[model samples]
Target: MAAVKLSGKSILALLLMYVVLIFVLQMWVGPRDRWAGYSVLTPLVAAALLPFRRTLLVGAFTLLAITGSYGFGVTGLSVGARFVVIMATALSFGISLIVCRVRLEREERVKRLMVARDRLSLLSAASSRVGGTLDVTSTARELAEVAALRFADSVTVDLFEPVLRGEDPQDLPADGCVTLRRAAHVTAVAATGRETTALRANSAGAGQNREVHVPARWLDPGRPAATRVLEGGEIGASGLPMPLPSAGTGAEGWVTAIAVPLTAGKATLGLAVFARGPGRAPFDADDLMLAEEIAMRAGVCVDNARRYTRERETSLTLQQSLLPDRPPEQQAADVATRYIPAGSQAGVGGDWFDVIPLSGARVALVVGDVVGHGVQASATMGRLRSAVRTLADIDLPPDELLTHLDDIVVKLSAESLGDHGTTPRGDIGATCLYAVYDPVSRDCTLASAGHPVPALRTPDGVCEFVDLPPGPPLGLGGLPFESVTLSLPEDSLIALYSDGLVESRHRDIDAGFKELKQVLAQHAGALEATCDNTLKVLVDDPPQDDVAVLLACTRALDASQVAVWEFARDPAVVSQAREAVSRQLSRWGLEGAVLTTELVVSELVTNAIRYGSGPVQLRLIRQKTLICEVSDGCNTAPHLRRARTYDEGGRGLFIIANVTERWGTRQSRRGKTIWTEQALAP
Candidate 1:
């Protein structure tokens, strides 16, 4: 039960009543041991009704009264009664004092329990709300916000510079000097209404998570307690003029603050600062413990985020290095491309595109997506992109190139199974669209491996998707890929893209395609602008998956730039072809190439006639280079063997090889075409 508290008037009345009672006991009930002990009654009453101090003062008064009665003889008192009064008054005072102390101790214990419960609530809030994501800045902001709400007036979380970028933080050195980036700073000033508190949001330094490197001495800014804490010491509290958040206002200084290390096991990732301004209660031991627990939780979260950041950075670096920043310049098409990586939460994705130059003034347009996210998918994308380039170098047709690519993916999946027992996507699945556009023929032969079809924009500005058949994606074995050959008009645009460009969470794939078609048809500009507009109109910000788009405009070789001739399998045609090539080169204003062209034409034509069967065909094309192609109906392949001193036949190909910039044979269903290119003057 609570002790009774008397009013000031009531306390005085009690004192007067004690005096009156003493008078009665000494004057009327004189010399009686029972009446003499009545002095004890006043102090006991005061103890029950008054505070400890009041009870003691009243007890002192009672003893003085008892002494006066015995010494002055106002009422004759027995020595025993006098002893009784002294003993009773002394015992009353002692009992009142002990009860008061016990009450005070109990109240203090209750207060501690209340504080413990609040801290527990704060810790619970931190766990549930803070570090809700694997993003470094986001988790730090969460920690600061959660702590500022209930525990401290202002909160700041500063982490090592590398930790913000998702890398491991170095340990605090012996000198305790290191630079840190301010991740989050949140301050809430107290308001009159507890229900509606004014929260002031502020970002650290100039911007959020800006890693501004300064002298290490500035970390604590003359705050000795914070410096010690940063030097691997325990949590420390101090009063110092700490810097406020960049946007902080209405609050200039802090009265007290505590700095706790953000630690995961023995590793210190950063520090969290919690402070109170004037009129707010200073942090005590309980608040420090609470801050430490929250910091520990934040540290683990930050470490997890850091790990993810590091992995993502590695993957992105690899992806960037593997992907082409700009397509290599080629004669077949004008090229432009755009690539945007996926958001941080969803992890990195594998989307890649390329414009690879092929032989015979041909260009290969490619876009592919590995069927997953993260470093594995990105690595897989690199491998697939490289494979496509290698196969394209052999002048493989679209269907054949994808077939080879699919085989590679299957082999990769098998390798993954051998190494890790399973691939990330069950079998290293990926989708690709490979289109080879030959400017000489004005034909684009394209094949899709479970990838989106290209949207073709003709010269007249009509846009539509070529409803070509799509084969199974790479990694699916035993699937035949079909290629569709379409003749593109000069300056026709083919937009090849990964699925991410036309896929999103909020819309169906068909809707995305429709929107993309409209955007392409409605917008007209440079190839670069078209790429930008395509992404802007069709894709959401921070795209759900990696996005890659390649836009290429086709160009054709004019009839005047090309020459062709057919002849019976005879050596006489070699000279006739050489004369005709001279005439064509003159007409094309390329008389300068006549000597090399005739030599290449004579050797390639002669070789086709000697070893090959059926009629022979010779063609010359002028673009960036002079191309001489000789086709014959022969299944046998030729090798460039060194001629003996007296050899008559092998010198023909050896001479052609030495005179030409590059020469190769392209095998065909009919027979084979041996082609050679000579550099043209710029």
Candidate 2:
């Protein structure tokens, strides 16, 4: 009867014992008297051993001998007794076998379901552990605990290079009924190829299982196994799991360690280990499965952390590189500048302003904005800024400069289009304003390329935008640009800005302009202060796009206070030129600064007279400073050169460059005007 609940050998031995029991029962009992009862019990005995089919066969034969006693007893009696006893025994055996087999099959199926549920529970717990900590060490320890509870007799987590190890490196509490061991065991695993090990309670303590060494590479064969050893240790790869070699303190025990490789991709991030007692059963398929999942989750989190670190570094570098290191030099006027990048974590867009000096005492002031953001936008801004500075210095008019810029953009589009297998037309465009100012003549010339018109403020504080029809944006329609001329009053200011300042998502262009005018009216005390306050009022937050502004205010000289002198034309004109200018300044109440004024005027007027066959006019004005303007009928522009030491005539412009704060020439329909300006004594 016990055979049904026993192993194969136990059932066989039980059958032999049953045979002896039957022989005793038969010999001691009176055959005829108990024959019918023994016959009925024969089938019951067979049924008891049915679950162990091989032993059941032996037991059935043993029972048959005992049943024969019943038949023998019945043979000694009447024919009716024998027939009843044999038939009843046979029927009982058949029914018992069927019932026992059915029950055993049901038990096996239930066992399988229990095993599957245990595995699912382990996986769910591991997933929860992943969410609690961003640090890899704590995550790894939690994962180990999950593994031990679900799969092994005990879990020994040997982290080679624990990616999840947090900064503090604290100990992870063991899972229920699990023994925790945190050690760098990757090298031993790689060299030995094991994930877990068991130690005997007496040998290393005693009552331990054999150690099994499992190589991390066993999970995914594609990853190289050897490189996973930890540094400065004999361990292979960065981390690996190693099973204990044996159950004893000595090295002679059964294999007990299993190693699990922790990795996101190719590199071994760390390892997990499982160990079983030497006499206990080896780890099953479910244990191996649980370890694999833990490693995979850990790998993903480590990869994310590394990626985040790299991106942050790159963004910081890019933003710093895009900003200017120092303010631009003031060539013709006092200048102040400030640049604020897009305040987001990524980067700033392309917004830049530059002031470049042109020949003949004119300065080109430029402000521009490139579209887009991040690395690409920063690069494009650099290119456009350099181009504008170059083109401006080459004496190109504002319209021509914009046209050349447009050509550059078109060329860039043609070259870069479809470069990445996608045609990106009209994806790039820039808004820029170029203004050329002659301090000497107090004339400001401007050209806009799909850019905002500058607001002009008179010396008396009257502010208005230069009323001109807007031209097409660069890289749009290739239209000819019209250069606008404005008579600049001394000490007046001109403000140029990118559209970002005057165009908002919530308002139209007209409204933005109105707002800009209001800001100027409220903060129009000083050039630098006005620009700073106006920008602060307009932009309370970082602009959604790039913004650039350039402000210039004239330091008008007073013409009424300028000295005047009349002289007769003389053959030796150099002395007369100097005398006429000096005497005029002395008469006009500027005797203290007459030397500088006289010297510049003499050179300019003398050059006009010597180089031309027409009349020339010399005039001086003083506003915030003194200015000397000489007009001649010749339309040819003057050249400033490093004159040879013996060349007396060519030193005129060179001398002017050293003496005045600024100077320039204006070519009008009448002829050309050359002028120089000097700062007044405070």
TM, every model: 0.80, 0.49
lDDT (10s digit) by residue, model 2, range 529-561: 887887786653745555677777664334455
Could you give candidate 1's per-residue lDDT for residues 421-490 as a string of tens digits? 6434445889999998888789999999999999998888799999899899898889899999999999
Candidate 1: count the clashes. 0
Model 1, C-alpha of 371: deviation from truth (Å): 1.9
> How far is 529's C-alpha from truth in model 2 (Å)?
6.2
Clash number for candidate 2 = 69
**Distance (Å) between predicted and true CA of 16, model 2?**
41
- Which window of 10 residues has the lowest lDDT sum in candidate 2? 184-193
Q: Best candidate, TM-score-wise?
A: 1
Each model's lDDT: 0.78, 0.60
Off by over 4 Å in 1: 1-114, 191-200, 204-252, 418-427, 643-648
Model 2 segments beyond 4 Å from truth? 1-337, 343-346, 356-364, 394-397, 411-428, 436-444, 454-466, 486-495, 502-518, 524-543, 550-555, 560-574, 584-606, 617-631, 637-682
